[model samples]
Target: MLCVVYKSPNKEGAYLYLERRDDFRQVPTALLDTFGKPQLITVLNLAKREHLAQIDIHKLQAALKTQGFYLQLPPPPENLLAQHKASLQNDKG
Candidate 1:
């Protein structure tokens, strides 16, 4: 199936994949408010197996099938800096 991907301007690294590029009317108002204006990213073909960086093809397919869209949120930071800082503080103490 072909899917249209939209990137959220308000939230960095957030994406919305939908069946129809122009059909966003079904998306909830609350979600839209948080999502902000969606910028057209790319159109992709969803096969059984494919190379997707942040999302699983099966999961994406299921979401698009059930909810008419799939939302991808950014992954959390590694937080190595915080751990390093804590270790430094412990050493100082």
Candidate 2:
């Protein structure tokens, strides 16, 4: 399967994948509004790829098949303070 990827202009590290290039018929208007204007990224052949850097290939494919689109959100920021506290507790035990 082939997909077109678009980066969100308002969001960093957010991407939208569609089964067809520039086709947003299947996507909801509210989602599109929040996603902001999409900037062209690339066209990808899912069949040729075994893995994706941020998204799971299988899950992406499934979403495309069922929903005609997939939204990739950036991972949550790591909390260093929480990690440090956990480490201190561990050291005391």
Q: Whose lDDT is greatest here? A: 2
Backbone clash tally (model 1): 0
| lDDT value, residue 75 of candidate 2 | 94
Q: Could you list the CA RMSD of all candidates, in the order they appear?
A: 2.8, 0.9
lDDT of 2: 0.96
38-83 in candidate 2: lDDT tens per residue? 9999999999999999899999999999999999999999999999
- Candidate 1 residues lying further than 4 Å off, grouped into runs, are 85-93
TM-score for all predictions?
0.81, 0.95
Point to the candidate with the largest TM-score.
2
Shift in Å, residue 41, candidate 2: 0.3
lDDT of 1 by residue, 1-93 (tens): 999999999999999899998688768889989999899998988763486987888889988888888889999988999999999999999
- In order, what lDDT does every prediction score? 0.89, 0.96
Q: Estimate the TM-score for candidate 1.
A: 0.81
